[model samples]
Target: MRIVIFSDIHGNAVALEAVLAHIRHETAPDLIIVAGDLVADGPRPAESLAILRALPNTRFVIGNTDYDVVHERDIEYDFTRAQLSAEDLQWLDDLPFAQTVAAAPGRELLVVHANPCDLRAAIKPDHSPAIIRPLLDGVSQEIVAFGHYHVPFVRTVDRYTLVDVASVGFPRDGLLRAVYVTLTFDGANWQIAHHRIAFDAEAVARDYAAVGYPNAERKARKLLEARYRHP
Candidate 1:
């Protein structure tokens, strides 16, 4: 079975369009998973949500930003939340915290936006075994797929496989491209591949000015011009 997993769209519809086109043209998969952070912090919240909503057979999870959209009492989120319809908010509110996908008969893949315990917890590529082991508590699946760090990585800890599918819109790897991961399970073993598709970063950055919020353009420009924070 072939499964494509992506996360952290963060409201950039342009980038999401490129990624969706690539998926349609390049391959057909059995399942699609959106780990989380589908909106907020970018230019096109409604458009982004529309694109994802149209996809078929896709599973979704709630991320930290997604949770904040519903519960946080902050003014910064108003514009993005306003663009969403009542149905959209309900969908976001109902998203699962985690899901287990059985790619093959006996091959199980656990999907979560971040750590199994907390949506805010991030598992960086360089974390020590001591730091990583606790995150696996109560997780029995041999393969664990997660996102939120916005950096793609495949790591082995004990007998478990950890995969971070990475971000689609606001990538912190400094490439300014959309990224996701595919996992192919062949009964016993799982194969992984990382895909990075390019989109118009400059145009999308300019879109922030018209996002209808205070200093939206400035905030967007700061994100676009900033250096990558993670290795």
Candidate 2:
């Protein structure tokens, strides 16, 4: 079985579209898991949500920003919040903190936005096994997938396999292109593939302007523009 997992789509519809196109033409995954932050930093929150909503065999888990938006706890999300409908907010609210599915007959796959105990807690790529050990305290799956730090990595700790799917929008790992992870069950164990798909970042930057964030000084506008330029 093949599975595609992505996360941290902080509302850049252009990036999400490019990744989705790759999934359609290349990966053709049997399952799609979106580990969260579906909307937060960039423009086109509603549009981004719509794209995932239209996909098949997809599951969503809530990230820190998504939790903030759904719970109305963050002021930074106000602009994107205004663009969403009540139904959209409800959908975000209903998303699970973690999802576990059967990958093979005996093996299981666990998906979470970040750490198992905390939605905002992040297990970064640079972290040592000692730092990563505590993060796996309550984790019960053999294969675990998570996202939050916006960086992609795969590591094995004793009996557990950990994967970070990285960011579909607003990547911070020194690459401008969107990043995600794909997993394939090879009968014995799972193999991981890290994907970086290029999109029309200029168009996404323009979208930020069209969505009422024309000022370069605004944090949201600056983030959207820098997403294409920076790591």
How good is model 1 by TM-score?
0.95
Model 1: per-residue Cα lDDT over 47-158, one tens digit each: 9999998899898999988888877767667877888898898899899999899865757999999988889889989999789899999887888999899888999989
Give me candidate 2's TM-score against the actual structure: 0.91
Candidate topping lDDT: 1
Per-residue lDDT, model 1, residue 152, is 83
How much lDDT does each candidate structure score? 0.86, 0.83
On a 0 to 100 scale, what is the lDDT of residue 105 in model 2?
A: 71
Which residue pairs collide, candidate 1? none
- In model 2, the runs with Cα more than 4 Å from the true position are 73-75, 214-231
What digit string (tens of lDDT, one per residue) describes model 2 on residues 48-98? 999989999998898888878877754557777888999999889888999
For candidate 1, give the lDDT. 0.86
Candidate 1 residue 80 Cα shift, in angstroms, is 1.0
